[model samples]
Target: MAAKQYKAIGEEAWKNNVEKVNAELFIFTYGSLVVQLVKDFEDYGAVNKQLDKMGYNIGVRLIDDILARTGIDKCADFHTTAEVVAKVGFRVFLNIAPAIANWSADAKEFSLILEDNPLNDFCELPPKAVQEGLWYSNVLCGVIRGALEMMQMQTEVWFVHDVLRGDDVSEIRVKLVKILDEEVPVGDE
Candidate 1:
């Protein structure tokens, strides 16, 4: 139903409606999801949690769009999948401002610098503190992370730029830093 409408519009049309669609999408989500999901929301905690949850929700739904756009129903390997995500998925679908960097060979993680993040204007924070806010709309990170995980690539996504501190025209950075496995210590020090 709704998915059909979205698909019918095509990516070209969607890009054209970036401003209008994004604005309307914000309004629709604000009115429906934010207001309805969070009860008695007053502080940053409630807002932040809600936004992250909202991103999770959107991530679930966005899987459909990702499939439609990429025609990738499945991945043969994580490396191939991450390449697809970095090259096609993020670049084409979301129209991210900054160029992304892929440092992971195993395809377990990747990173990017996001310029002119869309969610920063609605909320502001220092570059170091951007992820600390409750009202921050970081659902896109969660969306990509969750969506890719389901697609068989366990990944973590996050932002590096905080656009609220007059950091407008800044880069939106996401990292896929590797997780070091804990090694067993030798018997004697």
Candidate 2:
């Protein structure tokens, strides 16, 4: 249940348990999806929204996989949640665990700093897309949001710095809105 434990579990899972994939193929597939979304929507904002929605759906299911793989209990707190997300969640899936930083005094917010993003590999945005406020990797934000929602933690995630947007590093800012309580079914309650 500790961060260190999660790190070791992530290493074990990534090395031995998880099925491998061709990074290039995965990247190309994702790239193609983004391109198709752009073509379909013809609007950068809409493309971002679609991508986020797709990611959210993925996240909702992905959490189940993570839980099954790790067999871990609910996160003790947001800080621990951040650690698990950085060390285990990202590592198992992306093979990258971003550095957690810029914590607010309230401890309700933090930033995940990625010096290198596999998603951005060989990806360069067009000037028009940049000008139109398109977040090429907006799916990641939705992923975090959806994953946390399933964990009963409502968090807002957004990209504050993106290498695609010419920032030095890709940073995702996560703010805890509140913890969602378990809900009873209409008839059961």
Candidate 3:
């Protein structure tokens, strides 16, 4: 019942806020960016880190857009937050709804299973990049980390599986480290 409501909200919000783009163009742009990153860093780890940083920055700003579009209030728990992220956040931004799975016993961690990734559309890692252990979608992890940070949830987000690397399912594992307390600056007080 709750899932259905969230889906409806996501669909309506996406319809109202999202700007439709050609999937091919989006794929081409992302591919070019990856190519440039590879050329600049040479090391796959460094490239992935840079991409994650880029996504983090984007996520920070994206949260504002999401809040404005969805008009969703503060979530009462991490579980609710995760549902919003999976249903509304990704759906509105990427037109894909990922499944939240693999919950921890304490509910402090879970996995997001991405069945369809826009960034992975028409994407194939070059043999050299694969050999160097590059994570092609590292940015997604960073985005989740940054967005959660802004929401006052300290979290570690990382990719655990990638279909591009021959995994049957692409998954991101997010661990809630702690909840951040809102602090007022001394000067402001």
TM-score of each: 0.57, 0.95, 0.94
Stretches of candidate 1 off by over 4 Å are 1-46, 77-79, 91-93, 102-107, 121-135, 165-189
In terms of lDDT, which candidate is strongest?
2
Candidate 2 per-residue lDDT over residues 1-189, each given as its tens digit: 666888998888789778989999998889999999999999999998888888888889888998899887898899999998898889989998899999999999999999978999979999999999888888988888899999999888888989999999999999999999988779996
| Model 3 lDDT tens row, 115-175 | 9888898888777877778889898888888888889998998888888888898999999
Q: Rank all candidate structures by their TM-score, best first, as comma-separated numbers.
A: 2, 3, 1
Of candidate 2, the 10-residue stretch with the lowest lDDT total is 1-10
Q: Across residues 1-189, which tens digit of lDDT does each residue of candidate 1 receive?
A: 232332343344346533344654654555455444434575556665656666667766776666775455565545455455544555445554244465556545555455655444344343543444543445666766666655544455654444554444443233444433445579845
lDDT per model, in order? 0.52, 0.90, 0.88
Quote model 1's TM-score: 0.57
- Pairs that collide, model 2: none
